[model samples]
Target: MPTKGMSPVSFSPSRASPSPSPSPSHHSPSSSPPTPRKTLSSSMIAENVDTAESIIRKWSVEDGSSSYCRLDSVFANDRTEAKDFLRSVKNIQSAMQFFVSEGTSSSSEQLVRAQKLMQMAMKRLQKEFHRILSSNRNNLDPESVSSRSSVSMSDFEDYEVASEEDDIQVTGNSVHEIVAGDSVSDLAMADLKAIADSMISSGYSKECMKIYKLVRKSILDENLYYLGVEKLSLSQIQKLDWDMVEGKIKSWLNAVKTAVKTLFLGERILCDVVFSTSPKISESCFAEIARDNAVTLFSFPEHVAKYKKLSPEKMFRLLDIYDSITDLWTEIESIFSFDSTSAVRSQAVNSLTKLGESVRAMLLDFETAIQKEGSKAPIQGGGVHPLTRYVMNYVGFLSDYSGTLSDILSDSPQNTRSPLPESYFSSPTCDDGSTSALSVRLAWLILVVLCKLDAKAEQYKDVALSYLFLANNLNYAVSKVRKSNLKLLLGEEWIENHEATLKQYTANYERMGWSKVLTSLPEENPTAEISPLEAREFFRRFNSGFEEAYKKQMSWVVPDARLRDEIKVSLAMKLVPAYTSFYNKYRGFFGREVGVVEPVVRYAPDDLGNYLSDLFYGTGAGSGSVSSSVSSSGRKVR
Candidate 1:
C-alpha cells in the first residue's frame, strides 16, 4: 500500500517461507525453519528486502536533496528511528558472516566488493544512529521515550485512532485527534491520555501503571511535587501558608485531568497520583495546620462557673477533630480495602500509618492547647472553681471513641498507657504508668488539670466549704475514671486517693461545723446568780445552734454513696447523743425556773438524727436553716 510516488521495499515471500523451491508454488510450504534463537540470522531476508537493497545501492551517494528525503522517510525524529537503525546494522552484521564462512569463494573478487559496500553502509548507519541517540538523550532519554508505543502523525492530523483501544470524544473525534498536538510533549500527553481513557477499570492496572509512571516522570521533570528548598521544621511549617502548596498540587492535577478528560482512568489511580506525588508532607506539616485550627477548641467561651461544668462545645470540638482526621484517611483506607496488589497495598498501609502518626501527634496539639489552659493562673475562689468538669467531660468524650482512635493510635507509643495523672491532694502515690508515650502525656496532662483545681480550691476562706468543694471534685474525678475506660490511665490507686481525700473532707467538715456547736454548750454553772435561768438559756442557745447546722446543710450533696452515708453517720454520732444529754440536764432547770416555759422540748436525739441524714446529696445548699445543737449518737449516750 505504498503511495504512487513513494518507493517501496519488495518482500520475497517464498525465500522467507520454508519452501525449498525459489519460485512461488501452489502447495503450502513445509514448516518454516526454526528462527535461530542463540544467534542472529545470517540468511538473506525475504526476496522483497533483498531486491529493494539492490535498488537502494543503485542510488548515488551524490543524489543530493532526494537522498535527504529518502532518509527522512525511513528515520523518525524519535527512539523508534534509532532502534530501527541499530536493528538494520545487526541484520547487516549477520549478512556479513558469510564473508567469514564461505571458505572458498569461486567468485572471490565480486564477493569482496559486495562485502565492502555492505560494510561501508553498516558503519555509516551506526554512526548516524549514535548521533541521533545523543540528540534525543539531550532532549529526553531514548530509553524513556522508547517504552511508549509510537503514534503516527496522521493519527492526530486527520485519521481517527478510535480503534477501541484509544477512546473517542463526545464529538466522536478521537482523543489523539483532539490532542495530537504539534510538539513531542503534546503528542506524548495526547497519546497517554488516549491510552488511559480507553483502558477499562478492571484487570488493567498493569497497563494503567504506565500512566502513573509517566505522571511521576512529568512531576519530576516539571518539579511539580517539590520546591528547590530544604524541609521545614514543625515551628516553621506552622508559620507557612500551605495554600500555595496545595493550590499548585491541585493545579497540576487539574491540567492532567483536563488533558485526559475524554479518556478517564478510574478515580482510584487519580487519587494515588494526586496524593503520592503531590508533595512531601510530613507529620510536622500536618501538626502545624491541625494545631492552629485546634487552638480555640477545648476551653470555655468565658470562664466556667464551677470545676465540673464544661460546656458542650468542648466535646463537640473533640468530635470534630476526630472527624476531620477520619476524612483525611478516607481515601487511603478505601484504596487499601479494595482488591489492590501487594505493592499498592504496601504503599497504602505505609501512607496511612505515616499519616496516622503525624496526625496522632497532631492530636497532641489538643493536648498542648489543653496543657496551655492548665498553664493559666488558676481561678482562686469559693464560688468559681478550676476546670475539672471540662477536663473530665473531655476525658469521657474521648473515651467514647477510644476503640476507633486506638486503631489510628495503634503501633504507636501514644496508645500505650491508660490516662489520668493524679489528684491535687499531692497524694502519696506515683502513677502506675502506661508503657506508651501518648498515654504518659495524656495522663500527666490530667494531673496538671487536677493540680490546677487543687490550687484554686485552697483559696476559699471557709475551710469546710473548701474541703467540700475539693471533696466533690475528687469524687467526680474518681467517678469519671472509675465509670469510664479511663481506669487504665488513672489506675485504681489514683481513684483510691480521690476517695481518701473525699473522706478526709467529710471528717474536716464534721470537725469545723460541729465543733462550734459542741463548744457553745455551757458547762454546769452552779455558782451563777440565776442558775436556773442560765440553764434554760444555755439549752436555748445550744438547741438553736444545732438546729441551724442541720437546716443549712440538709441540701448539700455528696455524690458517692459510701461517703454520703459515712458523713451522715458521723453527724448522727456526734449530734444526737450530746444533744439528748444536754437536753436532759437543762430540762429540769427550765421547769424549775417557772418563767422559761420548759425551754421548748424541741428535739429528742432521734429527731435531730433524722435531720443529719440529708447532708451531701447532689442538690446544693438552700437557705431555710435554723440552728440545732446535736450530739454524735454516741456522745448523746455519754
Candidate 2:
C-alpha cells in the first residue's frame, strides 16, 4: 500500500494527528507521483466559517440576542444594508472593548464574542488601509501563520481593547535614576547648605544651626572632601545673594555672650523664656521646661568651655549666671509652701532636686579644677578663688532650695507615714566648715526645725538619730571640724532642751490617762501583786457606788443652785463610810500601847472602871462631864 518516493509516517495517540493522507489517484508520472503535502486550503476556511456561523446562531437563540448581527450585516450586499452593517460593527467594537476591559472572562459567550469582535475590527482596519493606497501598490496578503505566531495573542488582545487613558507607566520606569559614581553625600550636603541659606535669609539662625547638624550627620569623614567642595560652591553662589548663615551664627554667639553677661550680673529678665516664665506657671510645667533647658546648656561641656574662651570675663560671667538663676529658684521656692495638687507637688520637688543636682555638679567641677590648680601653686591658707566663692554662693542657693523642698515634702500627705525620700536626705555636702555646700545637711536641719516647731517628739527623735549617725560617719579629714561646728551651731542647750521636752511630753501623755505607756514599759520592771478578791471588790465598788455618786453629782450641779439637798445627802453617804474605814484602819495600826498594860481588876476604883467602860462601850449619850473626863484621860495616855 506504500507508494514509491513517499516516506512512511507513524501515528501515536499522544502525538499531534499526522497530516491527512494524500489521495492515491493524483500520483506523479515519474517513478511515483510526489507525495502531496497536506494543507488547509480555502475550502477548510469556508468550512470553519460555516461552523462558526452555526455556533453564533445557536448562541443567539440561547442568549436571546444575536451577537453575530454585525458579521451578518457586513456580508449582506445592499447599500442601505452596508451602511447599517458599518454602524453595527462600530457598536460591536465598542461593546466588545467594554466587555474585555470590565467583564469577567469566565463566561464562554462573552469571551467568544469579544474575540470575534476584535478580529473583525482588525480586518476592517486592514481594508481601510488598503483603500487609502494607490492602484500601483502591491496587494497586501493576509497574515501568514508564522508571522501571526510571532505576535502574542494576549498582547494583541490588550492592544485592541485597552483604553489609551489606562496606559500608566510603573514606578520602576518613573523613578529618577542615580548614575554611577554619583555621591549621595555631596547631594545631601548641598541640600543642607541650601536649607541653611534659606533659614538665614528668613531670619532663622537657630533653624540654620539645626540644618548644619543634619548635614554633618549626612557626611562622614571619608566623604568630607566631596561635601567640602559642594559646600564651597554653594557658599560662593550664596555670597552674591542674600545668604548670611555664617553671619547669623556669629550673631547668635554674640547674643549668647550678652545673655551670659547679663545672667552673671544677676539680671533674670535676660534669661531664656523657659527660665523667665517658670516661676509664673504651675510648678510641674516650670520644672519640666527648666530641666530640659538646663540639660541642653550643660550637655556639651566641651562646647561650653570653648565658648568661655571668647572672654575670660565670660567664664566668670557664666558662673554668675548659674548663681543668679539658682537664686531665683530659691526665691520662688520661698513664696510657695507646698503645691496643693500631687502632680504639681511632685514636679516642684523634682525640679528642686534637679536644680540641686546641677548646682552640685557645677560646684564639683569648679572645686576639682580649683584644687588641681591650687595644688600646683603656693596658695596659702587654702583661700578660695573668686570662681570658688561664686560656686560656694551658688551652692548656698542650692541648699536653700533643698531646705524648701524638704519643707514641702514634710507638709505633704503622702509622705506622712514614710521617711524622707533619699533624694531629699542624700544630697551631697561640702567638707568645708561653713554652710557653703550644706544643702542636704540644711534640709535635715530644716526637718529638725519643723519638728521643733510642730513639737513632733517621734520625728525629732528620728532626726537626732540620723544626724548623729551622719556626723559620726563623716570623712576623717573633716569629721572633727564639722562635728565642732555642728555642736557650736546647734548649741549645748539644744540637746538638754530636747531631752527635757521629750520627758515633759512623755509625762503629760501618762498623766492624761494614756495606758499605752504601761505596756511600753521595759519587761524588767517589777509587776505589782494584786489578790483576785481585792481586785474584784475594787471593781465592784467602783462600778456601783462610784458611778452612782458621779451621776448624782453631775446632775445635782444645776444652774443657780449652790447645793442641792439630794447632792448633800449623796455626798454624806459616800464620805461617811470612807471616813469610818480610815478611822478603823488607823486606830488598829497605832492605837495599841507598846508598853505593858496593867490589868484592870473588878476591885479597881469604881470611878476609873466606870470611866473605862464608858469610853469602851458608850452607845447612849454620855454625860458631858464624863465625856470630858474621858477625853482628858485619853490625852494623858498619849
lDDT of each: 0.42, 0.29
Cα lDDT over the full model 2: 0.29
TM-score of 1: 0.41
Q: Residue-wise lDDT of candidate 2 within 215-257, one digit each (tens)?
A: 2222221122221211222234234322243343333334323
The candidate that wins on TM-score is 1
Give per-residue CA lDDT, model 1, range 1-638, as digits (tens): 11221122221111121112222323347755546752242334322235434433433233353344434412334433322333333333343345334433422332344444444343333223222322332232222332222434333334223332234343322223344334543333343333222221112222334334333333222321232212223344334444543342234333322211211112223222212222222122222222221111111111111112223333333333334334434433432233322233343344345444444555565566655663344233222243777777776666665555555655666555445433422222334523334344445656666676676666666676666667667677777878876676445666676677768876887787677666655544323344666665666676677767656555455655665666666676665666667666656644444465344555566556545654555344322221344433422210
Cα-based RMSD of the predictions, in order?
A: 17.3, 34.4
Off by over 4 Å in 2: 1-216, 219-504, 514-638
